[model samples]
Target chain A: MRIFDPHIHMTSRTTDDYEAMHAAGVRAVVEPSFWLGQPRTSPQSFTDYFDALLGWEPFRAAQYGIAHHCTLALNPKEANDPRCTPVLAELPRYLLKDQVVAVGEIGYDSMTPAEDAALEAQLQLAADHGLPALVHTPHRDKLQGLRRTVQMVRACALDPERVLLDHLNETTVREAKDSGAWLGFSVYPDTKMDEARMVEVLRAYGPEKVLVNSAADWGRSDPLKTAKVGEAMLRSGFGEDDVDLVLWRNPVAFYAQSGRLRLDTPAAGATFEGNSILRGTPGAPDVPAPVGS
Target chain B: MTTVPARHDTPADTGAPGLPPGLDGPARAWLADALTEAARAAQAEADPGGTWQIRFAEAGRRCGPGHADAARVELLAAARPGVADLTALYRQGTAAERRAVLLALGRLEPAAAEGLALVEDALRTNDTSLVAAALGPYAAAHLPAHAWRHGVLKCLFTGVPVAAVAGLSARARGDGELGRMLRAYAAERTAAGRPVPHDLTRVLALTEEP
Candidate 1:
């Protein structure tokens, strides 16, 4: 099972998490830029975050043979933050880079007016840059958020097929399915859908354009949820091909829209910007000077 | 683990010495069937991954110059539709999609003309990915030796790792001509104080008869 976790917050994860993920069949991941639990005071913070996504994180994932790609956005919650809004202007350059697969994790956090403007603006960015979108339905009023999200998305110039309304569950799957957009369910430890529930969605929906993710961020989320979903699907009478379709191919199909996806390439290298994920420091003296001792 | 079909152990499946013979074989047949299916519903879009493309993806065919590699050939069959409608897709698709088409062409003629044409066009591009893709498994089997060697240099010039050139071993080994070209290119880069590409060393080593 060569898994591609279409959505996992590896930025909030560790090197060990990457190793565990690789051991568990996760071959690639997309770490969408989103709200970091606390509100960021400025866009400079986002600039640094985005840089790490393109650089350090990729290098880190490469150490374990996982390909790392990211989806960039101001994020729904942050769109309301005037301090972080400057990121919207700075997105074009980053969006054009090869690793950025989509304009994402962008949609209603609170379903605020500011979010609406940001979402509309970013949707245009996706259209301009020719990338898909990974949208977040509002958790508080998800049904309403999903409704407003589908409406605004249909109204936008972006193609509905290229849009993914993420964090979906039973309440919103029907509308998302009817919207001609892609479906995404984030399985988590507590709040979001779990593996059994995810399997139910796959059984009901038939897994056409559905994409399952772990959405494992800094929150108390399980990174192995995607693999678990695959297992659950198999246990529930789904075929191996069907499991492969929902977990592996679906994400590849979604992000391959960027035309820059090269999943076959193995990423392996250690140093970056004079820093090393390796053990030894260059030109450093040996720990034990036997002669002196 | 999911039950992936074991690779066909036939001579062509290895691609051990060169790309599989495109001349009337299972490789050719699989490609034709895929093309016919792809034309009808394979997402031959400018982009590689789309809903229609999922069929090809389900066939487990990735968007590359189609390789005869095991995993690639498995999805050659699926719950797919037709392929006769591919002319426009072949003519108008993006380099990525076009590369996919060329890959699926194998060695079948007439249709081979279009695939080879796209391969030639890709070779002419400055786009490193496209140029690298131009030398994929399909190109490895079909591109003439001269154009193939130049393609190797292009990989060096463009900083595309030579490994991306599918048949590096079989193509590079014992090719004295390629060895000379690589040496001259490396010397020129050294003289200009431009660091020679790291891959030049690997391919230069591959030029060894052993």
Candidate 2:
């Protein structure tokens, strides 16, 4: 019942979420640095956030027995901000770090020229770093975004096998499969695919290099979605081996291309980056201690 | 529906260099690489920033927890750097690297004062990893009893598992100051309706037994 969710944003999540995910059999997670709910003004903000992801977040996840890895990138949304473009230059040093398994959440938020440049540059960075690429297809006009994304990836020097086109749907899964790239889907509450629909995708597509994620982040999502999908596959009569392929093995194979997907470390201590999730409450009125003082 | 079979390689555990005995070859190779990388980073510059430490951790992640612990030791063995040099790495490192530096300080020659200052700095942070790391063997051997006892309570206050304190039982066995702090801390937690750390009671009992 071990699970490895290939895409999740743990920075936006609490330590409670890590405990729940680990309890639900999520042994590992890859938290690609994506857009926060609010826009970041400068590259320095992204730098601090990346430091936490590579440094603090892994420590956090390890506290709950989950292995945390990350993908480094100037997300498509921020790529459009002229002020944030400096992030692309800042990304090289981050890409050199071992925990960064891919260059990702890159592709298009609005299909702007800026996004195109960022995506192209990152694809090269991925090649340079010898890591994989996780491309986030545009939420709007997804069908068109998926097609354009696959085409742009094809033009890059990286092999198609190294590209993971994520946030895909029924409309684009077939084309993504045909593109000779790894296919990904983020099951969500109201948008994208759901548990039952994901089962359908599995039945029709047969789980060849397809990775499913929760995309759980600063939004309405569930950290346990990958496990839920595994349960759905079981209920729908998929064998344990088939379920393992999508839920665990597929992601391991993809990230291992970077030679960096070591998923065995149990969450080590109870604290993250040496910080524990617990805090003492400042008493309402000074009761002057519980009298054992 | 068309299908193309993809091969998923189950990541295997390799032993780190200078790890405890009975580990496999791959693990030794893995740890060896980690130690080498960490040493390289520590020597790369007066400051390599977080890059080398990050790389060391990447290698550390590839192995088991036991060997991972050893990798930190091996890093110092491989680096052979002075305490001043190691302290600089700690200051410039991210939490992961600092933890490694903290782990290696006990083995470093001269037991540098700079190393203890780094430990004190880590204790000041809300970061549980630093606090837990700061309480390792080096701190137990070097940090004053008063500061060391406070380090124990810092673990309790932060909910950092008391198990991470490198030498807990021997250290807290008969320390009166720590006992007092634990009682006060527990009382405060209770008055606030907090769960009071589960280990505080065990540690409290340990102190009272003698």
Q: What lDDT is reached at residue A22 by model 2?
A: 75
Q: Put down candidate 2 lDDT per residue, A20-119, tens digits, no spaces.
A: 7877788889999988855566899999999999887887677566788999899887786666889888888999898899998889864667778988
Candidate 1 lands at a TM-score of 0.56
Worst 10 residues of 1 chain B by lDDT: B73-82
Candidate with best lDDT? 2
Every model's DockQ, to 2 decimals? 0.01, 0.01
Q: State TM-scores per candidate.
A: 0.56, 0.56
TM value for model 2: 0.56
Give interface RMSD, every candidate, in order. Answer: 27.2, 22.1
For candidate 1, state the interface root-mean-square deviation in angstroms to 1 decimal. 27.2
Stretches of candidate 2 exceeding 4 Å from the true structure: A266-274, A280-293, B1-210
